[model samples]
Target chain A: MNVLVQGVLLGGFYALLACGLSLMFGVMRIINLAHGDIAVIGAYLVWVLVNQTSMPPWLAALLVLPIMWVAGYVMYVLLLERSRRAGQLVPLLTTFGLAIVIENVLLQIFSPDDHSLLSSTGTLATSSISFGGLTISIFGMLTLATAVVVLIGLQFFLSRTTSGRQMRATAEDPDVAELVGINARAVYAKATAIAVAIAGLGGIFLAIRQTFNPSTGPTQLIFAFEAVVIGGFGSPWGTLLGGIVLGVAQVIGAQVNPQYFVLFGHLVFLAVLASPRGGLLSRRGRTV
Target chain B: MIRARGGQLSGGFRVQRWTRLSVVSAAVTVAVIVVLAVVPFLFGADVTEQLTSLLIFVILAVMWNALAGYGGLISVGQQAFIGLGAYGTIFLTQHGIAPYEAMILAGLGAGAVAVPTSLIMLRLRGGQFAIGMWVVAEVFGILVTLDAGLGGGTGISLNGLDVFAPGYRQAYTFWVTLACTTVLLGLVFFLLRRRIGTSLQAVLDDEEAAASLGVNVVRSKRVLFVVAAVGCGIAGALYLANTLFIQTTSVFGVQWTAYMLFMVLVGGLGTFEGPIIGAIIFYLIQAQFGDSGAWYFVGLGATAIAFALFLPHGIWGAVDRRLQLRLLPVGYTLRKLDTPASAGADPAATDT
Candidate 1:
């Protein structure tokens, strides 16, 4: 039961990691192989702010979010926008290339050693609450709460706001949206901005929860991608469910044997692929 | 439509598929092959080893081009088959099979595994397919790590090759590498010349139209996948033969796909001459900068991105367009006579 609870909390972190990926794919039809790397960049930014400037971790996260948003906007405008028109494979390869560049650059700057934001988080990293033979780490609960808030907040913004509707309009049919005077490029830029801001927030949570390195981005990407796929590609809430499923599977697999943990998540993902519905909660069969 | 020429109507016009450039290129290619075949006798062991690596890379690039450039299945996980091939060779050699025979079986083994893998992987489209392949490769990597006999996370070396003299092994491996490159290139060329090649082109251009036109999209993709797997598998076995060592991380690394992508994109995607040119370009680049650590990868990734964005057709494509060169001339091109009547007519009007 404790393992399952811990797994659910872990799922929240995975969901947070995957939401930006899901948003980018939903709005722009880009898989964004660099998503995880960019998230790591966000974490590194926070690390710099906290350690170099001696700022509080929360304050560092707060400052870094806008920077990440602008970075995301620039990344989309400069790199992805051009490749998006080339072909289906071009954007993917472009992002993959970008991922390599980002990872290696990070490696060069930070070296291959691991780093953590735990020290910056003060007692938040060690705090926990006990109830009915179950102890929940305060950081874990905070991550889960943040995930719920972000998901609900995004859902509301998308369904209610004017710019959000415009983003949706652009996603559905770019030409139609253009004909309707929606400024598809602007919508894309904003969508990328929000997606990246969310990823930055997730990165902070990730750094607090675990140690990270330059090379960890690929593994993070694999986990987030598995969550996105298992949750169904486009749906945001489904991503949370998918993350939980993956998290639970890993925990159970660990319970059986530690080596099987990651393998179990992959097996569940493959099983989902083999199913008739394609994903656990996907509405449509085609990915786009 | 018949053209009246010199008071006589001509009903037939010749369609020239082969250009002078193609003929010259073919002659040059044969000459190069002849030279490569005799290289072992002329060069020392180190040079032979380098050439063998080059050949293996060429095989990989060509097969990858055939799969992605032609078949439109941009897989990022071909390393899976490469790893499988190496492990397969290791397993077979551990049982006392000849290393050369084990290499062939490794190719077959990879192809056989690809059959079922394609069934699941082919269900994805475009980017999903690419990521799905990466996942499958990850799964394969993990599975290899779980097997204790396979050295788990660490790796093993081929043991039986010690029976042969080092010089003999080097020469034999070089010959086999050359032969594999020839067979893979020949297979791609053969496929391109047949109707299947045209169908593949049609499918790549537009899947819906090709399916409507009776192209078996799934089956063609499956064939390409299996063929590519076999090629990579063979190359993987040769890689072990050359190094006599295999590790999970090095063999199953994503760096292989990065190199493949860089080569294909820089050379030209979807062109026969492109992979050859790309492989040579990549070999040259690697030779110069491969020892530079992370900077090499940074440069490789930057090059791939630059090519993807600006030079999507690659170097050969740019040259082909500028010079109207058709080195492999697999598609038909109708050339018109200098007569005024044929001057603005449709190029496809000529049929013979």
Candidate 2:
């Protein structure tokens, strides 16, 4: 039961990391390989703010969110947009290059030392709440709550708001959306902005709960990517469930043998990929 | 669609495959090979070591070109095979086998493993495929760490190679790697020269259209994927033979893929000569700035992005545009016939 609780809580973090990736792919058919690195950058920004200004981590996080949003918007316009015009695969390669650049730059600046948001958060990071015969870390619960709130808010935004609807319309068919006076480029930029901001949120949460270094980005990316895949592509709520599944599988795998935790998660992802129910992505290579 | 067969002029035009330029290029290639083969006799361990690294990069660049450039599959997980090749050699050496023979077997073993993995990996398209391959590498890395015999992440070095003196061992390693490089290069050249090459081009253009035209898109991709795995696996084993170490972190590093990407993109994507040039340039850069660490990687990453964005065709592509040279002639070129009758046949022909 404890394992199950821990797993679900862990799933919340994965869901948080994955939502931005899902959103980017859903809106632009882009898989931003640098998604994890962007999240790390957010964390680093918040860290710098907290360290230099002696500001509260929460306030630092609040300040970083808008900055990340602006960064995302600009990044899309300047880098991704041009690469997209180049070719389908160019964006992916460009993002990978971006990831490498971000990681190494972080390393250069931070000097590979591990940092945790717990230092600024006092004892809140370790504090836990007992409920239904299970004790859970408050930080973990906070991350889960944030994930649920973000997903619900995103759902509402996409379904109800005019801008969100425009974004969806653009995603459905950019040409038709453009025909209808919707600026697809602007819509894409907005979507990218939202996605990247959310990724920053995930990063801030991750820093509170775990230690991170510059190289943490790739592992985070794999987990988030796995969640996206396991949940099925382009679905937000499904991503949450997928995250839970992955988290639970990993926790359970850890229970069996600590070393197999990550390996088991990868195996589960491969299993999901191999399963016939994988749908659109798995059914690819029809020409083969 | 018209392939030049070289040897004779057609329609009073010299639209042939093997031109004098090709012959000169071939001579240059052979001369380079001869020099490489005798490097141990001329230089110390350091030169041979650096040359071996160059050869490994060339193998990686060429194989990556085959996979992403020609096969239309961009994989970041090729390190899985490289890791396997490195660890497989260690595993075999621990089992009382000769390290030299183990390297070959390990490479072949990685290739054999690729056939099954491709079924799982090839399902993904575009970016998913790219990261999915990375996940596969992670999985392989974790699996290696699980077995105690494999060093459980601490990693092991090649045993049973102590019988060879340092000089002979270095020479043997260089020779074996050289031989493998030649064969793999030949294999890629051979594969590209066949009808499969055309089918691969068709698939790269439009998979559905290629399939409609009877091109086996899946087969072409799978073949290239497996070949890449084999090449990388061999490179890994060769790397092990050179360094005498086999650590999961280093062997399965993403930097290997980055190097491959740098070579392919910087030289020229989807071109035979491009990767070779890219690898050489990359080697030179590494030799110069390799010890600078993080800043070096930053520069590399920035350069790669610049190339991907602005010069998508890369350095070789720019040069080829001006020179119109085809050293390997894997691609076709169309030229007008020199005969007056052929010129007269075209009403809109320009008079020069």
Candidate 3:
């Protein structure tokens, strides 16, 4: 029972990791191979702020969010926008190049050593609540709450707000959106910014959960990608469900043997791939 | 068939498939291959090792180019095959097969794996296919790591290589690499000359159009995927032979795909000579800055970005445009008639 609960909470974190990826792909039709690296960079930013300025983790994350948003905007304007016109492969390669640069840059700066933000969190790192013969980490509860809040908030924003509707419009058809008086480029940039900011939040949760190094991006990417694929690509709520499925699988695999944890998740992903329906939550036969 | 008259029907012009430049390029290529084949005899172990590595990179770049450049399948999971090949060779040699012979078997083994892998991987398109390939690679990496006989994560070395002297081993490995590079390139060249190559180009240009025009898009893509897997597998075996070591992390690393991408994109895509130029340029760059650690990757990534943005067609594309050069002429160019007499004098050309 405790393992199941823990798995669900862990799923919340995985959902966070995947949300930005889902959002970016939903809006821009880009796979963004650098998505994981950018999240790592966000975590690094939080680490730098908390360590260098002696700020609280939450405070550092708060400050880092808008910065990441701007970073995303700048990345789009400087690199992705230009490559978008070249070909389908160009933008993917551009992001790949950016990932390599970010990871190597992080390695150069951090020296490949694992760093965790848990040190500064003190009680938050250790505190847990017990209920009905099961214990849950307080941080895990907070992560779950954050993920729910973010998902609902994004759902509302996309469905209700003007900018959100614009984003949806652009996502459905960029040229059509432009024809309907929506600035597709602006919508894309805004969507990217939001995606990056959310990824920054995911990064904070990741730092709190485990030790990470520069090279950890690719592993995180695989997990996030699996979660997204399982949930159904480009579906927000589906992403949350996918994360839970992946987390549960990993936890169950861990119960059998620690080595089987990641392997089981991969096996599940492959099974999903082989399924006739495509994915668990895929809406249409064609993916975003 | 001999109709002789006035200006209407005098003679026929012969279509030329081989240009003077192509002949010269072919001769130069053969000369280079001869020199490369004899490198181990002329130089010491270090130079031999470097040349072998270069040849391996060439093989990888060429194979990647064939898949992505011509077939339009931009897979990031080719490292999966590379790892499989290395592990396959290691497995074979452990079973008493000669190391040199095991390399060939390893390639076949990789191709065998690719057959089933393509069934799943080929169902995806565009970016989905790219990420799907990555997932497959991750799966392969984990499975390899889980196997206890393969030494798990710590990896294993090729033990049977010690049967030969160090000099003989180095030379033999170099010769194997040379043969692999020659055969792989020769295969690609021959494929481009065949009708299947034209179909591949058609598929790359537009899958729907090709499908409508009766091109077997699925078969062509599968063939390209298998060929690339075989080439990468052989490269992987050569890599293990040279280093005599195999690790899941190093062999199955995404860095291999990164290098392949950098080489193909920076050199030029969809050109026979592009990957060769790209691989040489990459070797030169790596030789100079490889020891710089992370900075080397940063430089490579930055260069790839710059090329993708500013020089989308790559170095060869620019060179080809400026010099009007085609090292391997797969496309036909109609010769213009310089005189009115020449226009009506070619009845055979009119039929073609």
Best by DockQ: 2
Each candidate's TM vs. the true structure?
0.95, 0.95, 0.94
What would the per-residue lDDT of candidate 1 be over residues A1-288, giving only the tens digit for each residue?
888998898888889999898888888888888888888998899998889999889889989999999998998899888988887888888998998999999988998999999888889988999999998889888998898899888888888999988988888899999999999988888888988898888888878889999988877788888899999888878899999889989989999999999989989999999899888889974332
Order candidates by DockQ, high to low: 2, 1, 3
Whole-structure CA lDDT of model 1: 0.87
Off by over 4 Å in 3: A285-288, B1-17, B334-352
For each candidate, the alpha-carbon lDDT, in order, equals 0.87, 0.87, 0.86
Q: Which lDDT tens digits does candidate 2 get at residues A156-269?
A: 999899998998888888999999999999998998999999999999988888889999999989999999899888777778988998999999999998987898889999
Model 1 pairs whose backbones collide: none
Docking class of 3: medium
Q: Give the TM-score of candidate 1.
A: 0.95
> Residue A44 CA error for candidate 3 (Å)?
0.9
How does the DockQ of candidate 3 come out?
A: 0.73
DockQ of each: 0.81, 0.83, 0.73
Provide the lowest-lDDT 10-residue window in model 2 chain B: B343-352
